[model samples]
Target: MNETAVTAASTAPAWLAAARAHANRPTLRMRMPFVVDGEDVGSVETVVMDRIVEHLPGGHRLFFHDAAWHLQSANGNATQAMNTLAQAMRELGLNGPWRNEQLVVCNEDGKRIGMIERGLVRPLAIATCAVHLIGTAPDGRMWVQQRAFNKANNPGMWDTLMGGMVSAADSLEQALERETWEEAGLRIADLQSLRHGGHVDFQQPAEEENNAGYMRERIDWFSAVVPAHIEPANQDGEVERFELWTTAVVHDHLARGEFTPEAALLLADYFGW
Candidate 1:
């Protein structure tokens, strides 16, 4: 890689980290009419984020992390506040930097209207970090199994080669490496080449509570094509079963709803048709 690419890549997280620092504070301001109680107030500049939460009497609550005059915010545009703070959290969670983006709310009439933040929420995806890896000479291929009948969500559905969750204190690569080692007995560096199948957020709507009760995470998808000469094996109980399948057979299973929706979509594209 050239020096420019290296420098840009190295500083990417720092930019996001900076954004997160300001995200919890009111460092951004823009004027837009706020829709409240069925009325569009003229050019109201609302606070999109603050680290504090202001509790109102009754079940009503306002996250003060993004602040503004109390009256204007009672029924203000929360889309911006929520999205920006979430973005900040995504960076903060990884101890990274922040970069400014549209922080969009939603798109309408070919125009984007919302806050100054990324306009989307990603699911906190949990999957096996990796499937195949180095070991004894490759014996055909290996089927990576995510312990069937999980105590949560899907109990016994086979998923793609790699999967995992992004913890509040871990970077994407760190989480992937840790999960791969714990679940599959392989380190991320062990596999030089990995492919991202895709990911899903799987979040629910917010409720009237202390926090929104929803976790947000943008899953970095992946796949590892280990040397055929090295066979991969299951290490922990998280994997209940293992079997080798040819790319064709895997394609067939993908056609039969056998993988995660995002993974299935990616696998479909991988198989081309």
Candidate 2:
């Protein structure tokens, strides 16, 4: 191999390490399966469960049984019950930053069970879905965004062109289109060579919540080519700014831990670095 190829081969491990660092799977030894209507939906840390039981409304029917936490007597209104519990938890300061958005809760088989507040997903260790878009300029430079400084999580970190949660009301396709427009001010139909880039599953402690919350997310990422004449403008105010960076510059930022872990994982997988 030539000198450049040798150097590239030597640095590939670092990229893999950076991505793998965010995939720490949770051990359920200290947690209990949160079951709804006889379906196990999530794994809640024991301490978090205790806090929830203590703060949940008196009318709620969440209880521990059969070695799992189960909601009893929801009467087909499990969504409402979960929302009530989530709101109560938030009121008692047991949840993460409240987004006032609802996320679909699903069982292991990906069956939708109910909906809960977005902020309570981590506290309850519920698996959530998100979409990320990776944009490349006509010259092959990647478009990255700086998160708003006041954001609740990973503030000021560089990220993929656009990334946002798949809200309860959106399908994967709808989320892709919506987040692209909201975060980048670019319509999906206007992009070139749009393609699905697979997904990455992340399970880690939510550092923003001081490790009191757990994050289990599946991020479906896509990539597209942005026309040179089109510039990305932030419409949602969640993005501080956007910059087009060469592959080398992105790699440097990844190595320096300047990118959010989720973004780093997707970018590394995209580049096969």
Tens digit per residue, CA lDDT, model 2, 1-273: 212223344436455674696577555347778887788877777676776776666476878888899875446778888888887777778888888899999989999888998988987789999999989887778899999999988999999999999999999999999999999999988999888978999988776774367789999999889999998999989999999997778889988889998998887667755
> Model 1, 1-273: lDDT tens per residue?
212112223212222333333213321234333232222211222332233223222222333123222212333554434443345445434211223433223222223233432212221111111222211113323244544574243456666454555443355667677667766666666664455444433222212112222222234555565555444455555665655665556656655656544344333333332
The alpha-carbon lDDT assigned to residue 25 of candidate 2 equals 58
Model 1, runs deviating above 4 Å: 1-142, 195-217, 233-236
Per-model TM against the reference: 0.43, 0.91
Candidate 2 Cα RMSD after full superposition onto the native fold (Å): 3.5
Candidate 2 overall Cα lDDT vs. reference? 0.83
Q: How many steric clashes between backbone atoms does each model show?
A: 31, 0
- Once superposed on the true structure, which residue ranges of model 2 sit more than 4 Å away at CA? 1-11, 27-29
Among these predicted structures, which one has the highest lDDT?
Answer: 2
